[model samples]
Target: MHAALNAAQRTLVREIATLGTESGVGLYIVGGFVRDLLLGGAVREVDLVVEGDAIGFTQTVFSRLGGRVTPHRRFGTAKWRLPRELATACGWTVLDFVMARSESYARPAALPVVKRAAIRDDLLRRDFTINTLAICLDAERAGVTLDFCGGAADLQQRLINVLHPRSFEDDPTRMLRAVRFAERLGCELAPATLQLIEPARAHVAALSGDRLRHELQLVFEEKHSANVLTRLNGFSLLAAIHPALANTADAWLADKLIAAEAAGAAAEVCWLLWLYRLPAAESRLVAQRLRLPVRLTAALQQAQQLGAQRNLGRKLASSEIVSVLAGVQDWALAALVIAAQDEQVRTNLQRYRNDLRYIKPLVTGHVLRARGLAAGPQYAKVLARLRDAWLDGEIHDAAGELALLDRLLLQR
Candidate 1:
């Protein structure tokens, strides 16, 4: 079939083809780029496969495109990332590249032994039919779509069918990918493909956490993330990954997140959906397992505390809300705001989010230290005392808080 390419895409493909020919190697635009083209979707990421040195050829092509090529000599792989602005200019509006020749998995769902191979061999090595398609980028075959596994037909049918029965076992993460493709393209998984995933779910542990996390994050970025999560739960893969994630006693938060998504909320809603169920302990476990960023970890902890207090109806008084807002930077209060059960809490959340509520502590450690309060735990205690009084409405203004601090210091 003749795959259409815009002028910019054609220009980029031409450049890659020229580079391949000049270097005496064959190159093919393969994988998701081909699949997305057949589906008429926007292609932003591109993967190119060469029948020669991937790293060497990538360096040549990147040089032509004036991109920074990072070569992984150990693995014989290379990456060329177009600048955000040039990404679209360079056929990225066409697809992103995952270039390699061929790969052979040692064990089912284990790392592959990669080596150079013909374009056909490379395409045949892919997990699914839709992903096995390739577009010839060379001048001789430009616009020619190659489908060794009937990927074009499957694309037409909007089906996610494995290239082989053992496809899932070769990489169980493909099960999630199948689900993502089904949701992203409004396709259905072939019956055999759906059946194959369950038995292969055990193989997921063999896959790297980074790979699994990437797939999970992609699924969550989808509009049907909640539905996808439900599907994963139904397939029993969710529990297999993290047993704690199963049987969520309170799925209200999940439901709320789904509702928010249905109303066109952004990706942050997905993070909040899991926060209610992920208490401090579980959050820490997950963070450790996922190697979460420190900022995200702290945010999760704060959200957990806020969720617990909100659940307990600890009615975030004006002061409590202000204090919480002061310490949080990122999505710190996302769960509290998203899962807030009370109108007052929601209103306060809005005020805090809009920067309408700012608290300038009326008393400081310096003042307390000067007032016969020695440094150390006492400084912390005095500050905490004043902050509490301010939050609890015991101190209404700076003068009132200072007066209370003075009296409290004198008593001390």
Candidate 2:
């Protein structure tokens, strides 16, 4: 298992082990890093737990390796970002360091109060059994695997099992994580763990909007995001985050997702499609509840409007099509095209995407101004006319554009 790590990861492990030996501090690679390592998956991030001062240990490692270390004194945690060139070479970005700590939630759906504890206690405090596995980086036990919570057995059984019954009550976000991990790892939620999902659903609302948004983003990041959404809906958890999705049907979303995947659409574009059927007011309400950024909300609004007008694209002239889709993003347009039902709408959208959208008159605003055409509201009208002529295939070259301009000037 130790040999599975890449050269960069192995180097990091050796250096941490040496630091532990010199400083007499216990160190181990823990959490997701260990789990992914055991699964023979790519390790893009490293999580480390130190039995002694985590910040001091991080500083020592940084001093030796020449990197920036950011410490959070209050949390007994620190993060080290490798220098850019080295990080590029290593295929990893950051290393997280935390003191071995146990947490106790003050109340249901509240943040935990943390305190330094033994490695065993730390392992027990984790969300899922699979994530509790750890690998020691200290010299004497350099490659020892620690599984105080039957994580290895659970991993072999392909089950996601919580460490305790009250786990979700303490941090409801774990419910979302359970679904994410179950879908991501192609595992099933243990029956006992599945039983708590309903009770945990009620507390998901207590989580802050930012945290909920983050979890939702993680779901969208997955390749099977549509399936994850279906699972969340089945768990009666989707509405707790926002009512818009709860009231709507997900069949169209599933179909659109398949098309979007084939089209190579981005996650944000897929999310916009999911919300495209809602009215602007309802979309705004959902966005506000989820704390979505202003730009994303606006994009959703535009996509909704465009998606509603998809049928009109086929009947409209080329210039009209350009006017309608002038500033819309390609992803948004592609998503709308996928959702469009009419073949002509699809054909027109394809045309716009491939050719018409890029058509513009060879004439420039500078040339128009040089012709003594005042730069004002009328300039836009004239330019629009010129561009429309080009898109309509009526103007083929600069001479044709100049002739059109002369006619417009004569008419003026």
When superposed on Cα atoms, how far off is each prediction in RMSD?
4.7, 2.6
- 44-105: candidate 1 lDDT, tens digit per residue: 45677776787778777766666677777656667777656667664452232344557777
Instruction: Score each candidate by Cα lDDT.
Output: 0.71, 0.84
lDDT of 2 by residue, 336-386 (tens): 788788877777778889998888777788988999998889888998899
Which candidate wins on lDDT?
2
Which 10 successive residues of model 1 have the least lDDT summed? Answer: 90-99
Candidate 1's C-alpha runs over 4 A off are: 1-6, 83-99, 248-254, 259-269, 310-318, 357-412
Choose the strongest candidate by TM-score: 2
Estimate the lDDT of model 1.
0.71
Residue 126 of candidate 2: its Cα lDDT?
93
The deviation in Å at residue 307 for candidate 1 is 1.6
